[model samples]
Target: MQGDQASVIGGAIEFIKEMQQLFHSLERKKKRRRSLSPTPSPKPPSLAAGELAAFCRSAAADVEAKISGSNVMLKTLSKRIPGQVVRIVAVLERQAFEILHLNISTVEDTVLYSFVIKIGLQCQLSVEELALEVQHSFSQESAF
Candidate 1:
């Protein structure tokens, strides 16, 4: 169990380091692109209020579904999961918009799409990892 904990901690630290490096690399690229482009880049279209609401609803439903299907989640956490997911999605959407605005001028459409997809996947994995960690912690406490 101690070994497992150490491995998990080490993996998380590595993940964080990699993410930091990625962000720094992206920042450098953004600066290079901005310097090369003299004209103002067109702003990426923001999601309409209705569209955002629809997205939130869909995300909440997904969370609810996962909670109902998963035995690992505590009852208390399950109740809050949908709301938390909506908030997480909202924040992610805002960050993605900012990233798009910053890089749209210089980055190819395919590259931007890939970047967004990667971020989304990473966020999902992070959330799942967190949930498992919480469940593990609670289970260990209950065993005491």
Candidate 2:
């Protein structure tokens, strides 16, 4: 019985040592991965002020046109849509800028332009979706 008890204690210690080694191994792997991964740029790539202004204007104009054309959009909402679109574009642009800087060594003008275009399109889609929801809500309210 004494010998059996000693063996059980030894087995537990062996298991604990194995677990410790495994934890250390995983920690080492995590450190290695962190070292190998590309670090984010200290500062995001600077967007030219002129280019940014041009993009905002173009995006706002496009949103205005869509809102104007939509029969279901309320006049008040239509007035606000362009400003909202600009805000959305600003947020998206900041995120995209960070992501671009992190993923690529250098950002090109064309790539930035394309990202802006995509952000504008996304904002347009969001506005359209909001319009649809508003229209549905209005229709439902009218029914009662």
lDDT scores in order = 0.31, 0.31
Give each model a TM-score. Answer: 0.28, 0.26
Q: List, residue by residue over 38-143, the lDDT tens digit for candidate 1.
A: 5443222243353311110121121110121121111111222313423433444543321221111112311110112223323443434433333333223222
Clashes of 1: 0
Highest lDDT against the true fold, candidate = 1
Tens digits of lDDT, candidate 2, 1-144? 999999899977964663454345335434644699654322222434432111112211211102212211111111122134334334445433211211111112111111112232224444444334323332232221
Residue 61 displacement (Å), model 2: 53
Clash totals for all candidate models = 0, 0
Question: Which regions in candidate 2 have their CA more than 4 angstroms from the true location?
Answer: 37-144
